[model samples]
Target: MEINIFEIAKSSPSGSAAVTFMSYTMMENLLKPDFFNTSNDTIKTMMSTVISATLPKTNYTKLTKPVNFTLKHIREFDHSGSLSCVYWNISEWIVDGCAVLETNSSYTVCSCVHLSTFALIMQTRGPQKSDPPLELLNLVCVIVGLVFFTLALLTFALCQWSPGVNNVARINICISLLLAHLLLLLTQKFLNLIRPQQVLCAVISGLLHFLFLSGFVWMFIEAVLLFICVKNLSQISSKKREVLSSGFLCVIGYVVALVVVCVSVGLVPEGYGSEHCWIKIDQGFIWSFLGPVCVILAVSSEYKHFHMGC
Candidate 1:
């Protein structure tokens, strides 16, 4: 019937002091050793459900272990001014529902909330079930895509014997696309776990948008390069057709993507995603990506048709 409360004082700068206390209460219906020793599964299950709801939900999330309740009555002031028991290691005291009252009574009633092993178990609920086939399919697809793209990039980079304008364009395209897909996959899988950090989420969103846009930009660059190479096939050795190089083409592709991403972010920084950490699809912000893509696709198609017609 006796509840023990432990009070600890915490001091802050600027002349401020606060006290945190932990209270442990015993329930005869739940904490009795004989009650848990029953061989009846139905009775134990019912008691667990009852105990889970017995704790006040307005303050505490889960119930602590039973040993936290034993306390001795003391009426004195020690040098440390702390009346805590060594058995009170079951939970760490929090300030959620802690208070101290001045009274002339033999014992004080205190309510406190703390995090413990039971709280973690309650928060986790139970083991989650997932479809094994679906999980395996998703894993296989990601692994295959990653491997193929990696090999494709290595091949494009290592093919030094037949290096040409087209090969250079393909290499840049592969690098950009590879980075974009890798970043997108990583962010999608991991960014959701750290939603509490706003700045980090924003940075992740910006990077994903930039990388994806860079991928698309490189694709567009490849298209243009293809068109130019085809158009100048007959004048392959002409100095006039040698204006663009691999490095110059890379600069154009990356710079264009960077400028678009930077301008979009600067104009409406909030346009970056909120929940999923991606570009916001609303408020014309997405047009920055779609507009350029549409223009490039149109130009490439037009040039292709014209070259074919000639």
Candidate 2:
């Protein structure tokens, strides 16, 4: 599309030479307009470089040029206008950046500064529609998961405190599971709101990593205890059970998980905060969590089979 832009007044010393605003009327086939913003520094710098390379270096000069840009992740947008302003839904929208040229006229070209989803906002020439239903469904599911996890934690707490309950290892397992689920659920629910805060996101990701690893380690401890109980059913007694107290179980389960999480973080700090509040799938860091869980499941399955044979 050909963009016709005007020059700004030279009297404005605060304006940079490279910054230029383009206002153009859309052709019959062009998409609608919207503003773009992002939190990615690399994308922001890239957009600035692209604009500088495309435009003439002179200040306050009106020049028309053919510019083409390919922006990644441009299918996401937030609607903020009435039906009279915006009408069409974007399908595979991907543009670098856009802004309102004038409220009355559909024109404004802005620089892009972040790696974000590109979206197209079209004017209301036709019917205006609302957002899709899938977003609502995701929110509902997260809320439901939060409620159920809360109940599970409460039930486990009561179980731990009940009379004749001597196995602290099982209680520790439940504690780790509940904490992991609670943190994960909270992160999922509020991630979008706090996404701009890189430090907060990194912290959340680290906590999630630690909590989940703890859960898995506790599960392994529970499996070991179960196997021991099943194998030594005849030798069980109050005096012998002193070796397997709650203190011993808690130390083993918590310490192992802590070590794994600390070592993982020390080796690859950046792996915690790039995407959703989870470890980056790149490298083999993900296996730190997956490997232990797989081994625990395998041992548990073998124990189950052995118990069934007896």
- Name the runs in model 2 displaced over 4 angstroms: 1-139, 159-167, 232-241, 301-310
Q: Which TM-score value belongs to model 2?
A: 0.51
| TM-score of each model, paired residue for residue | 0.53, 0.51
Write one digit per residue (lDDT tens) for candidate 1, span 1-310. Answer: 1222122111112232222334334332333322322222221111111111122222322323222222223322211122211111223312233333322223333333432211100011122356788867866776677788889889877767544456666676677667767766676567547545766777877776777677777787777667766666556436523557667777887888888888987898777755566666767777877887888788878977888899
For residues 231-269, write the lDDT of model 2, one tens digit per residue.
665455354457667777778788877887788778876
By TM-score, the best candidate is 1
Off by over 4 Å in 1: 1-139, 161-165, 234-237, 240-242
Tell how far residue 173 is off in model 1, in angstroms: 1.7
Clashes of each: 0, 11
